[model samples]
Structure formats: C-alpha cells, structure tokens
Target: MLIDTYGRVATDLRVSLTDRCNLRCTYCMPEEGLSWLAKPDLLTDEEIVRLVRVAVTALGVTEVRFTGGEPLLRPGLVGIVQECAALEPRPQLSLTTNGIGLGRTAAALKEAGLDRVNVSLDTLRPEVFKTLTRRDRHQDVLAGLAAAHEAGLTPVKVNSVLMPGHNADEAPDLLAWAVAHDYELRFIEQMPLDAQHGWKREGMITAGDILASLRTRFTLTEEAGERGSAPAERWLVDGGPHRVGVIGSVTRPFCAACDRTRLTADGQIRTCLFASEETDLRAALRSGAPDEELARIWRQAMWGKKAGSGLDDPSFLQPQRPMSAIGG
Candidate 1:
C-alpha cells in the first residue's frame, strides 16, 4: 500500500478521459473552450486500463472514478468500464458526468459494470440552467436522470455547485426534489480553479452558509458511520432516505483526509486538486520503462506531495489551467 508523506493512503483515483466537454459552464470552461489536448496525446483506452491496474494492484487503490470534460463523451468509455470491472479485487467503479449524453450511454455503462454515477446539475429552472450552462439541454439532463433510474442506477447522486446569486437560492428546492426522488444530493462550495473566468472570493458561497439556509427549511440530522475518503459532511433530512452532503473544498478544505490522486487524460499524475505541478507518467509509460522503475517514479512523486492545498492561503495563486484540464 502506498501512502503519501502526509499519511493519506492512495486509495482512490480519478481518471479524466478527455479534456473536451460539450457544455461551456462558466466555472469549468471559458466561454470559448481552451485549446484541447491533441488526439494522440490523450491516453488511449488500453493505456487507461493499464494505469488503473497499476493504481489498484500496486498502490492499494480501492475506488476508481471516471471523470472528464464529460467521460461519456469518450468513444471507448464502455470498453474502459468493462476493463476496470475485470480487476482482481474489483474496485468500486463510478463515473461523474454532466448527464448531457447519459440518456444514450447509461444503460451501456451499467452493463459494462459501472456501480454508481454522480450527475452535475445546478438548477431546476430551465432558463437558469441555460444561463448557467449556456446550453438549452435542461430537458435532456432530466431525461437522462430518469433513464439512469430506469436502468437500475438507483439513488443516483446529483452534484450542485452552489454559486452565490446564481443558484444558491435553489438549495431548498433542489434538496426537496432529491428527497422526493430518493437521490443523494451534494452541495459543493465553488472553488477558485478558474479565477480568470470570473471566480472571485467575494462571489463564492461557503458550505456553512448553504447548510444554515437548508436548516431553516428542514431539520437536518448528522449522518453517523459514514466512512472512507468521502469529503462530504453527510446529513439526513427528517423522514427521508435522501442524504444531503456538503463538499466544502473551498471554505472548509478537506486537505487532511484527501486520499485521492488524479490522472490527467494525457497521463500526468496530480496529487492534489490545487496542485500546480504534475509528474509526467505518460512519458515514462510510453518509453518502455520497467515496472519497478515506474513504481519508483510513482513513489518519488508521492513523496513530494504537498502537506495541503492551502486554498485559503493568501499567497495561493490560482492554477493557470482550468478545472476541465485538471479533471475537477
């Protein structure tokens, strides 16, 4: 088992399949998406599987999450899922999607052994959705959620980024809807990943503020016995199986319990979400380096893991890359 210098186990890995996304959400991508990684530069399906194998078998990784600019957009996503499912001690396999193309791909994903899904949705109102995403596919996302439920992906998780003045007012309504549908709802604090794209500290909404607002509407009971590397502070609403989670990566960072590492679409290993430097694993992998040498490289990289992201530190400079590039 590989443990970083900070004492966090390397148990979960988020692999970004591509840097390209269909929607240009203000927080994630620029109005015009940045120049994308060249086709040959992105890790192929086979390379992704090999990396997953290394992470799980050698590094004690127990959970594998496929992320993206929208993982479903990748052509060989189902095949990749199939390969991940065949691992010896099969890790808990999941995917995070924008739910745009899920209507056509959810069934195939489930058939290929995906265990769960988390969909990114901010508002229930169509116009607000369009204003937020710059796309008029609100109905399509709703349809995709329904399709996922029909395909037996029960209690699908919905991820909502709470942005002040934009969708913060919708928290109560969103939680109520989640309770009705028996889906887990998570409220994420907006981070400063793309500061140039209008991410200001003043424009941010904290997790505490969100919880306080929700408490006014429903009596929230803290969930006990929650486990693993989950960053969310889980709570249960009165008389519902619906769990409300707050991912306070910004206002209340979870750098202490961060057990996850990320692999960019091009095979760079990022130890932290806010990390500016990345270890070039693709170059080493493609160069026919021996397994022991690759393991040594991984070890060296993990040793250099920073103590914390220090997001609130005034000295912190926003990463030059966008969230899409880093697989947030």
Candidate 2:
C-alpha cells in the first residue's frame, strides 16, 4: 500500500513524462531556461508504463496523473495514456499541462482514455500572460481550455498562481472567466520551486489574499466537508455547486494528508516536493531488476516520506531541482 511511517498511504502517483516545456513561465524557470535532461536520461514509454503498472497492480495506486514541464510536448503521450488505461483495476488517468499545445491534443488525449485535465492559466489579459510566461500564447491557452471542455474533460480545472505585482489583481476576473466557462478554478500560492530560486514568502500571494480578492466580486461559502488528501481548500462560489480552490502550499501546508508519490522523468522517486534526495528507479530498471524488486524499492522509498514539507523550518533549503524538473 506504500504506507509511510506516518501512516499515510500513497494512493496517488504523479509521473513526469519530460522535463521540457514550450512556455517559460517566469515563476517556473528563467526566460533563458535551465539545462534540460538529455534524451537518454528520460524514461522510455515502456519504462513509464511498466512503473505505472507496478504502482497500480502491486503498490495500490488508484490515481495516476501525468505531469511535465509541459506534458503536451511528449510525443508519445496519447499512446502512454492508452496503455495505462488498459491496466487491471484501471486507475483514473489525468494530465497537467501548460495548455499551449493542448488545443490540438486535448481531443486525442481524451480519446486515449485520459479522464480529465488541469491546465495552467494565470491571467485573462493577454499582455499579462505574455509578461508572466515570456510568450505570446494566451489565446492558445484559452483555445486549449475550450478544446478540453469540448472533448468532454468534465470539470476542467484551471490552475493559477498569483504572483504579486504581476497578475495578482486578476483573481476576480480569472474566477469570473472560469465560472462562465464551467472550468473549476484553483489559485495556488507560489512556492520556492522556481529554477531561478527567487521566490519569497512575503512576495508570493497567500490563500487569504485569494479569498479576499474573490469575495470582492462573489460570495464564497466554505464547502462543508473534510478536504481529504486534496491540497486545494475549496469554497462554494456564489453559494452553489460552482466553486473555487486555493492551494496554499506555502502558508497552509497540507502535508499531513498528502497521499501522493512522484516519479521523475528520469525515474527518480520523490516523496516530497521539497525533498533533498531522490530514490533511483531508473538504474534499477535498466539493470534488470524484477517486478517484485522494483515494487519493494518503491515501497521502501515511500516509507521514508517526511512528515511535512518543512517550509516553516528556519533552515529549510529550496530543492536543487526546479518545479519543471521535479514535475508539479
């Protein structure tokens, strides 16, 4: 069950298909970009599928989310989704993408057995989007979101990171846009995950700020229920089924309920986003380790999961790898 010493079982797995992305969001990477992994270092389609099979069939993972610097950039993505869907007790499949190329691929991915998608879109204004992403693809993202919806990716989620002095003022407008389009909106507090290592607690927006900004335009009622292992704190928008979510990874860490284990594009297992070390599965896979051995290694890796992200600790150091390399 991949149960940790803390008694938290990891039933959700995040797999990074590639560390490559099309848009260079300022919060994620420098405009010039960081050095990307070489092609050989990334797990092949077969390797990725095998690991996912083991996670579901052996380790009991019920949810598998494919993430990337931009998952849409992975050429074999549709095929990968198809293979993962064929697993016995088939896990719910989803993808996290920047949404640039999604406009063209959403339908194909949905047909390939992808259950849904979460697209990153920070601002409604094209100029703000351009400044934040260092790319002129705002329209592309909107089109992509529409395509995902058209593809019947129900409850399409939009992930927004509020950067102070940038698109912070657009919270209400973003929510309004999301609601109008039937896209579930989630505002995530920026963490120290950028490749540039420039994030500061004071500079990033908080969950409080997002709610306050939202209240100015709409009434939000705290949705009645335990949040479970989901990171987002959901609020019923305008008092109904429509809602907005805030993932305060910095201010309101939900590590206590975390049920996710991450697999890097290179096959390293990361138990926490801020983890200083990674467990090497690539080496084991390449060296002809059997399935049981692979599952044992994974179980051992997750058993050492940290109690919390330690962002509050005075000595906390940002992880060496950026969000792009680690997968969101």
Best-fitting candidate, measured by TM-score?
2
Q: State, as a TM-score between 0 and 1, how close model 1 is to the true structure.
A: 0.96
Number of the predicted model whose lDDT against the real structure is largest: 2
User: Model 1's lDDT to the true fold?
Assistant: 0.85
**Model 1, range 1-328, lDDT digits (tens) per residue?**
6578778777889999998888878787777737998999999898899988888887788999999888888999999999999998999899888998889988988999999889999999999889888899999888888778878776699999876667878889999998887778999988877635567777678898899989989989888884456889889898546689999887877777788888999999888888889999899889998666666777678778888887888878787767887886
Let me know the TM-score candidate 2 reaches against the reference structure: 0.99
TM-score of each: 0.96, 0.99
lDDT of every predicted structure (CA atoms): 0.85, 0.93
The sequence of per-residue lDDT tens digits that candidate 2 reaches over residues 105-214 is 98998989999999999998889899999999999999999999999987799999988888889999999989899999999999899999998876578899889999
